[model samples]
Target chain A: MNIEIRKASEKEVPFLVRTIIDAEKSGTSILPYEKIFGLSEDETENILNSILKQNEEDCELSMDAFLVAFHDNKPIGAVSAWIEALNDVSSSVIKGNLLRQHLSMKNLINASKYWQNLQEVHFDIPVKSIQIGLVYVAEEARGNRLAEKLIKQQLEVLQKKINQKEEKVFVQVYHNNLSAIKAYNRIGFEIIETKENLDKNLLGVLPDTKKVLMQLINIKNE
Target chain B: MNKTEVISQLTPIFQIVFNNPEIQISENLTANDVKGWNSLTHMILMSNIEESFKIKFSLREINKMQNVGDLISLIESKK
Candidate 1:
């Protein structure tokens, strides 16, 4: 089957949002109100509105890219990436210089706390790695190699567009998602960090849930 | 090896892994039949099998394995 990966257009934000909600329903199963990012209709609308607003201004909080996978003109899956500024307030201040030079000073001051609180990973390396946020294959479309196809196609596109040697790919998966973890490992992603403690913190906020984050690093092996 | 030989070989592994006496295994036996076959237990089983068989399983094969028969097939292929 021919699978096509295309940039999610502004017109398709609703569809993308819907797909994410449906996928989260079967995928995460997080209880309502306990969800960090609400998945309900109105909440999804708010999220989409924020994304659209950022897109219109070309000033996103994070370097974001969303793509949708389709087969025979029917959407099957979607994936998104965001380049996070792990740390370095000075660098972020410099980077924000593009928005407004006058606000650069204020931006630096305001962003200091946010940037300071930013979760630190391995950032000494030259590679500007991205955190894969959303990777969802429709429940019906799963297990037919569609997930593999979607991921491999995206990897190929990213490799061609980005410097593979300098860019590392990363994703967080729940430790219980054995199949997903297995598939990711088959695609050459290795577990770099296990956020077992984060699971406990999340459980406190969530009341009852056991979600462990498994970080996969796509760096070249030594 | 035939199915019985495969089962006979796997019986000891299952017995030790699950700590169950008189553990019965068949071509269709799966983790669902045994208690404590979660992710951690699965890792232990995989490590033990790898050491015993002197063969490592890729994450793909490990995840796709549904029963003892699937594992036997993977082991046979390795040999």
Candidate 2:
């Protein structure tokens, strides 16, 4: 497929931001930040860029956690993975702190209105698991298995940073994202957990009420 | 505001943010020690604290915060 995947650099901030926005959308048009936090798409992009450019490996949101795939010198796909609980701080705490720093008081206040509802569908990736997220491939670059290549290459990089012998690798996805589910299944990930919330209030705040956690153990064991 | 005053004020914020009226704010309290203290509500909690204290936390300050003691200390210093 002529796809070359490498650790993303600061120069790829724009691409990484797009990949994150797309991945967070989960193949849907609903961008949670905009709907839940009252952030404009541009505002969300700027915040994402701020978080990404900082190069903090605190969570999946950090740019240092992502691997970019390039075909013909243009980025086509990207994926982020991180070992949770570095130095005793959970990725959620680090990520929350990061967002608290960048998000405006106004946005945060607006988020407070919807934040409680987010809890209804909130899914936490355990502290020790290797969480793989923000998996995205450019539309033009699809159908070539670029996502699969990016994820495998990303695992190779993450396996070194993670110290433990056997760490459960996880990816959370909307159950309706059949394409993503199919892709993860191809890579030996199985659905280990599923949470469904049928509340009608989540119509705009979340893309889907049903979410699933996919797990992979020992890439080589496949 | 003194630590006592901060703790007194902070107690309600924590309880309301976590939606647990039974919570008693203590120095040793960490995110793991509190139920419903996950990433989804953390920012809302921070912003609420800012409004209550009328202070903004820098990225470094937010990142360095470890527990309730650190939070009260930071808020006290900021106030």
Candidate 3:
């Protein structure tokens, strides 16, 4: 396969939206995007498209923040990562503000009503650190280091934008996603923090509330 | 309501959401001025503001808010 990776453009919003939703679900049927806002797949897709249409590096939601991996000129998998503090604003602030702006009033009301369950799984990434927000690979492309390639390529892309000393890279994933954790482990990432929801009701809203933060330790500059 | 009335009402909402009673709702105040004004709190604050003012902010309106003054203007426009 002729593998190629590059930053996604605006025209690829549909693919990136699907990729993001899939990454959020993590091989499950429950989509947090829908559950959080009480929106359907179509509604989530539409709002996500509007959010990703922006060219700026607004963390994970920005179109330019995602790197697409294509096998033989066909996009197969993708990953989204960015520096935490862009424009001196926190990543969470950027993302949350964007969501607040784009989501419909009814959806935001739903989110407000059940903010408790959502907050249970919410955590902030460190400032000035490299944050990996979403990752998804096609089933046919499994076990091929495709995820590692996409991530490494994204890191390299973000490396030039960093002016800090000793950059720390972080990726948050559900604790139940053993395969993804194992994949990250192979790429020299280890669990540095874990957050679990003590509220059992959150289970109905999301598949799992236990999230693990993985940090890259042996990242090499080749 | 006037800007003064809006500011007076918003102070309590900001205080409650940010958990910073000392936060003064100045026109130039931004998320940078408050310590706990991250994404989660921002959303919560928006929800609380909508509930207190009984207004639904449009997407464009929310994006236009840059500082406390902008927020006050948006609220006044909605009213």
Candidate 4:
């Protein structure tokens, strides 16, 4: 089987958005927008597509930020990585879009409560580092170390583009997602810290499920 | 080698890597089926399998394996 990993093109935005939604549902099972706003799959896709479209104009969530894995010419998995500071800006845009989508009063309250709870336990991401997020491997394509491959490839690309000072890279995984955490660990990432007491009321997850922050420093060697 | 022989060789490796002697593995068993058989241990398991079977797998071959049965088939083909 021929495997190709490359930056996603604008034509693949719809596919990337769908992959992200599917990955969020299957991998994490923590649907922040879905649970709060009762969004259907199509609704979520529309929102994400709009975000990607906007990204083309301002790069808030550009396709270049994503790397798609194709096996035998079929897309099987994807990962998105960028500088941490970009996320802070893109998140505000996402939240604005959510509000403009006219979320109900009850859902608005729920979103507020969720953000409050998240803010309490959130860790400040380290500066001068590339942050990896939205990691997903197709359900059937799992168990083959595709996630590790995607991560390593992204790291290699980022290392050449950035300076020597910005050598650290990090990824955040849900504490309960042991497989993902373990995958990152095998890729030389260490658990820097964990943010506890994530608001599970809206997410409908177990109380023990916490968000973990893991980092891989010194990617030059690996 | 037959399926039973391959499994018999793999069972001890799984036990040693996962630190669980009672781990029962079947052809259809996956990472989700076995406790502590996560991504990190999965790599270690792959390395151990390669050493035991004296076969090396490419990244494509490795990603294609979905379960013990798939792995056993790959091993058989390599041999």
Tens digits of per-residue lDDT for model 4, B1-79: 8878888888898887667789877877755456444333444566667778988776446545556788788888887
Which stretches of model 4 miss by more than 4 angstroms?
A26-30, A56-61, A86-109, A198-208, A218-222, B1-79
Give the lowest summed-lDDT range of ten residues in model 4 chain B. Answer: B35-44
Model 3, span B1-79: residue lDDT tens: 8999999999999877765678789987766556656665777788789999999876556655667888899899888
Q: Clashes per prediction?
A: 0, 0, 0, 0
TM-score of chain B of 1: 0.86
Please provide TM-scores computed only on chain A for all of the candidate models, following their numbering: 0.62, 0.93, 0.93, 0.80
lDDT of 1 at A141: 76
Find the candidate with the highest TM-score and give its number.
2
All DockQ scores:
0.01, 0.54, 0.33, 0.01
In angstroms, how far off is B65's CA in candidate 1? 49
Error of 1 at A18 (Å): 2.9
Write one digit per residue (lDDT tens) for candidate 1, span B1-79. 6656666777788777656677888777655455544322344456566777788666445545556778888888886
Best by lDDT: 2
- Top candidate by DockQ: 2
lDDT (0 to 1) per candidate: 0.51, 0.81, 0.79, 0.64
For candidate 1, the lDDT comes to 0.51
Candidate 4 lDDT over A20-128, as tens digits, reads: 6755554645565576456666777777786665553112245677889988767888887775333222222222432333334454444444443444444544434
* Docking band of candidate 1: incorrect
Better of 1 and 3 by lDDT: 3
Query: Across residues A111-181, which tens digit of lDDT does each residue of candidate 3 receive?
Result: 66556555555656666788888998888887788989999988877778886547889998998899999
Give one digit per residue, the lDDT tens place, for model 1 in A43-91: 4455544444344211121223557778888777876654433231111
RMSD to native, candidate 2: 2.3
